[model samples]
Target: MATITAVVNLDLPGPTISRHVYGHFAEHLGRCIYGGFWVGEDSDVPNVRGIRRDVVDALRALGIPNLRWPGGCFADDYHWEDGIGPRDQRPRMVNSHWGDVVEDNSFGTHEFMDLCELLGADAYISGNIGSGSVREMSDWIEYLTRADDSPMATLRRANGRDEPWKVPFWGLGNEAWGCGGNLRVEQFASLARQYATYTRDHADNRVYRIAAGAHEDDYHWTETLMRSFDPLDRDDRPATPFQAVSLHYYTRTGSWAEKGKATEFSTDEWYLALSRASWMEELVARHSTVMDRYDPAKKVGLVVDEWGTWWDVEPGTNPGFLYQQNTLRDALVASVHLDAFHRHADRVVMANIAQTVNVLQAMILTDPESGALVLTPTYHVFEMNRGHHDAAALDVHLKGAPEKEVDGRTLGLVSASASTRGDSALVSLSNLDADTAHTVTLDLRGRDVVGHRARVLTAPELAAHNTASAPETVAPRDHDDVRLRDGRLEIDLPAHSYVTLELTLSPTPSQPLVPR
Candidate 1:
């Protein structure tokens, strides 16, 4: 490992990290919608719309604030009407892209919005533009969100729900630059305008209409959306239809074709995974620059709905199913991503990581055969860092580095962020070096931290993970190893580990840190 800079400035103002940023996705592809979160209504597992009640309860326990349903690729072909009323009567469509499996429109509009209610989450719908049209998109929005007592509202009431869902977030399409349809911005922009025109405002609802946004680091696509928005309309009365511009990014350790699925990978592989995750900064900076040019008021929020590492799945699992193993490395990547989100909290209002349960760095995985469920390492990171959601972000200045060197590549260590909640202050720090642990000094200059103590979660190897038999392998522990002498707090970070320090200003000592 080479010596590098780990400088952090905790003085910049950042927006509140949306609780929705901890949101999840569920696509109809693979087991994500089937055996994963769904179990047939009477399989001795209990379900709603073939969705497991246990899964719903667990996600609610994790405080999942918002959920995106339908598809990444699957959303393009989904028809809302087919999924209502009777299950057996629903039409079966072919899932051409995913195992050529037949889709039994059993789980559709009403089912998804109902699940949102069960999970107590805000609903984010991805409209189909590639295969769906202005009318279909318009009607679906009307069916779910409109309360004007229209035909769609009557249809919804007949289907069992009397009130509209009032879903806050709605996407124009999914991956327009790729799976949704390889449409140029000029083409997508016109299509977006058409759809927004029909999917207009309804009652008791102020939908945050999200335009199908750019992929990673694609500045020009954001440019087109902003330019096409044309703040000044034909009547010069501000006519941009979109409330939020979106971005979709997925990280890969290596090209998917080069390597097959495996639980254990090389340090190089681990580094590659992390390096891809680190691009959150670049994606935001470049995209934000375009928004600055056209939408200078920062009125439209940035939404990154589909994200997370897309690694190979476990053996014998459907590759299209995307059932991959989760590890400590994934957890760390999650922590860093959350930190990045906190840093860029101003522009980025909401995001969801690809598919939730049983797919792509999932928070939880279930066993259909054994009726078992387990929380992945990625799950724990969200639990630990969830405190930052809706909290003000503070910038911290650091003077050191956790430099990493692998096969001619070098990167720094020591990433940090500070946030204050009410009277308590907290700092999240990560040692980004894979081989070298560093002693970090946190200068709490702005606020007066008198008799407070430090709490830490760390490990020496830094790549440690948890298994079913050994679930405590990567759990956080109290670091008595921390020292807070002279108001200048110092702590030791293990190689490539993450730690959260809560600074309390109580005159009395709280209990010793509990490592639960």
Candidate 2:
């Protein structure tokens, strides 16, 4: 068997992996809100106060730390006031951004906050800046978070919700460089500063405002935004314009017009998909360098608020729904992107996958008419790697690089990231090669292995996915190809698989002066 060796140093610690890094994004596109997650109380969709119960329970099980709502360009067009009063009296408008579908102001602020509360997840509210006024944005914040007897707060109370919701994260705008407003970097920066200036704090909830940021490799946008905040510490600048700036990148294989379907793809497309997924590493590294140049202190974070594979909408579905099947390739993509996020946790404080349900690389797929929900392969990967949240990332070194060749380009075969919390350590490993199984020898240096368990997500075919008929077509299974003996862990990793190994480490010896 082809072998790859790795040594994980328990003593060498990297940055603390933030739980918020495993965040999710929920847009108001297609069925993501209406039929996917929020099937009204009157519907027979097994809902908890209008929110889908199965979706809520599934996301809750994954320990979702935060969820960004009503976005992906939808936030820019949304007017918050129209969605607050009685449902029957609410105004309806066309969602010109996605399929031009009619958006009945049914699922608004209250419904979103309720869903977040139900899932025990933090709400990252993306404010409307493109078509919304400063007063409108300010009043929206006041309505949700303000606890005082202000006019907006009073209106919120009269709407039926007496208590204020704790909205911790706020996006001043989203994608201002494009659909957000088509504004230049400086224009977006100035408008963001002005809009963020009036957004007041309520009670103890101090919102973390995120300025709309760059598209892929747009270094100038990052630089300009950073320069805009250069005088933040000075007496003249506004009150710290933003706590974070976002970067949006998607792993879109092939052309936009010819974007391939989610499941029906050749092995060539699979290899190309893996290659595109690996680009995230370079993006994060280059973006971090630019961010460091401007903010040496690393006070501001780099939030990847929008990401994931954007394939063509599923066949026969609404072209704007962006519904795509999740396969083992997507699972591997999640592993790759998540591992990159963990490595750059020092600066990449938070990231929200493009969407959470019925969208690009969604975690759960729901058949609204049938009330059937199926967890995707990407969901299992997230569930398996939950231990990495809030843990300290550790350094791991590989002895030799395992590689695979697809077409003319060579791609690395493995991605491994380790993290420790208290006495337990978790390691996530992915073999990117589609046809090579690797037996890996992991040297658990300076740690006594007490217990070990493995879970793997893979399938016989690269394009295997769970359809409504066969929901378990590509699900996780208990893996026994791993063994821990005398501090060394041996894993027989399968091709095109993502595995998570949980290890219970014993305390290190108090006195140690020997160098191996």
> Number of the top candidate by TM-score?
2
lDDT of 2: 0.87
Q: What is the lDDT of candidate 1?
A: 0.75
Candidate 2: where is the Cα deviation over 4 Å?
Answer: 231-239, 405-410, 484-487, 508-516
User: Can you write out model 1's per-residue Cα lDDT over 1-516, one digit (the tens) per residue?
Assistant: 333223333334466667877889999978888777666676688777677888887788778999888887888988888788788899899887777889998778877887888898998988899899899989888888777679998998888888788788888987788888999888998898788778777876878888889888788888888887756424555656887888988777667584423357767777766776777877887788778776666777898888887777788887778777777777777777777777777788888987788888788777757767777767877766766767778876556464566435554456677776665666777776667767776666544454444444545444565555655666676666566545456677777677887765433344332221
Residue 425, candidate 2: alpha-carbon lDDT: 88
Model 1 / residue 300 / CA error / Å = 1.5
lDDT of 2 by residue, 323-392 (tens): 8888888989889999889889899999999789998999999875666898999999999999999999
Candidate 2 has a TM-score of 0.96
Off by over 4 Å in 1: 1-13, 46-50, 232-239, 259-262, 405-410, 450-464, 505-516
Residue pairs clashing, model 2 = none
